[model samples]
Target: MTKAKVGIIFGGKSAEHEVSLQSAKNIVDAIDKDKYDVVLLGIDKDGKWHLNDQSSYLLNEENPKLIQLNKTNKGVAIVPGEVTDQLVNLSGSEALGQLDVVFPILHGTLGEDGSIQGMLRLANLPFVGTGVLGSAVSMDKDIAKRLLKEAGISVAKSVTLTKNKRDQINYEEVKTKLGLPMFIKPANQGSSVGVSKVRNEQEFNAGINDAFLYDHKLLIEETVIGREVECAVLGNENPIASLPGEILPQTDFYSYESKYIDEKGADLAIPADLTDELTKKVQEAAVEVFQSLNCEGLARVDFFLKDDGELVVNEVNTLPGFTRISMYPKLWDISGISYPELINKLIELAIERHQRDLQLKNAVYED
Candidate 1:
């Protein structure tokens, strides 16, 4: 059996570019070498796509893919749906090889924010993770909450804001509505970049401005003091949920530093302690949110268990961290999936979804 060609797209024009690199490394290392004729597609901070070592421009200054990965360098991405048999170059000339699928490992913005998904959809390629709609909703905290709330899932009360709405943005309104000492995070970001805890009005304005730098929208979540829990879900239409894990942030909150930089920023408690009933409820909630977003490939559903012992949905991560030691994989690891097995499963799931999508009757004239 010929190994399927997979373009592992990584590093992007986002603040989480470094994190994306780590994720790409993990996937590149894990995918079954026997079954995958891997293609390393590196999209640097400038968003220029490169295959192999052709363009050293825009490569991670400290970390280079060429230094680590030895694979065929396929230059440029042929945007999906163009009627050309050849994959167009970044300059829109020539064709790259036919790809079985794409595995975009971007974090935040263009990667997780649905921009890349849109391209994959247009190209008619089966890529990993949620589709554009699901990606968009899940990436934005504000939108995710609205949809989750509508789906009968308990979500923290949040007030959204943008730069244009600054004047109209009532600090007092948020204070009265969601209260103070709440979380202020960029709506469409991950890795906790530009996220802060606003304890007062002065800090609230500063936090909003800080968040707006990363994204136009900001979410002020009413702090739900509880056990930080996470569950990994994979597959489409009857996806399975892995056992939940508890995140003990080694900081005031799960900030960017705690998530990656700081060595002692957090600890994980796998198969979190819970009653059988509570466990079932958490799993059900995770799957429910997955369905609500119409997610396909995978997601890491985060939750907050209130001091009252009630579970509250935090947000769904369409593309959670996968740095080998990340929670999504670790949680599933303790649940029985190995790192390589997890990657293989994701790839298999992507192929399954693509075939399923292709199977949908296209013509209105069904005999």
Candidate 2:
């Protein structure tokens, strides 16, 4: 039997570029070599794609903050509208070989915001994670909350603001509405890149400025007093939710540094201590959120499990972090799936979804 060639695309123009590099490295290492052939596709901070060598693709591989994609002269470009899954070399205009499927280990902005997914769709290639619409909807916190709320799922109370409304932002007004110790974050960013926990007027003013640095739109959310719990969902039509995991943040919150940089920043509680009833509720809610957002393949549904036994949806990560300590894979790992097995399952899911999509009609014929 011929092994499937898997293209693992990582790094991006987003602030989470370093995080993506880390994820790609882990996937490349853990992926079953006997069943699949791995290809390294790295994207730089400037948004250029390159055919990276798997062994030496990352610089400072041990340090999360310092880790980065090693610059490569072998640039690559996707040939859209082609079903062959071929990537072209920029310099010589040569074929970079065909891939059976692509695993985009990218996080935030262009990678997770439907941009790369749309490009892959145009190329008629199968890629891991959610589709374009699902990716777009899940990446934007503001839009995601609205949809979840409409679907009868509880989400954090948040006020969305665009760049044009910057002047209209009144610290006192927002403080009164959201109360003290609110969370300010970019609407479209992940890994808590520009997230800030502001407790006073001064912090609120500063947080607003900081969040806007990442995206034109921002979200001011009322801080929920609850434990941070997450559930990982897998599959397409009949998706299943894994056992919930808890994040014990050592810092004020799960900041970017705590998530990626600091080794002891947070303690992960796999299969979080919860009553069977509460676990069932969370699992059910997670699957509902996945289906509600039309998410296929996989997603990590974050929630604030209130002391009163209420589960408020925080946000949905379509392409959640796959870092060694990342919650998405860890949760599944505790739920009977190993790291390598999880990677294989994701690729299978991607191919499954692509085959289903191929059966859809793209045009109407006039008789």
Clashing pairs in 1: 80-122, 80-123, 81-123, 87-95, 87-96, 250-265
lDDT of 2 by residue, 16-114 (tens): 998898898889889999999998899998888889887789999988878988989999988986556378999999887788899998899998889
| Residue 122, model 1: Cα distance from true site in angstroms | 1.5
Candidate 1 lDDT, 1-367, residue by residue in tens: 8888887888778988777777877776677889888876877556667775423423343342222322334457666565434255655466766888888988899998789988887788878888899998899888888888888889998888887887898778788998768888988998889999999889988988899899888888898878998989988877999999888987888877677556577887888888787778888888988999888889999999887878899888899988745789988898899888988888888888888889888799977
Native RMSD of candidate 2 (Å):
1.2
Model 1 CA lDDT for position 116: 93
On lDDT, the candidate that comes out on top is 2
C-alpha positional error of residue 130 in candidate 2 after TM-score superposition, expressed in Å: 0.3
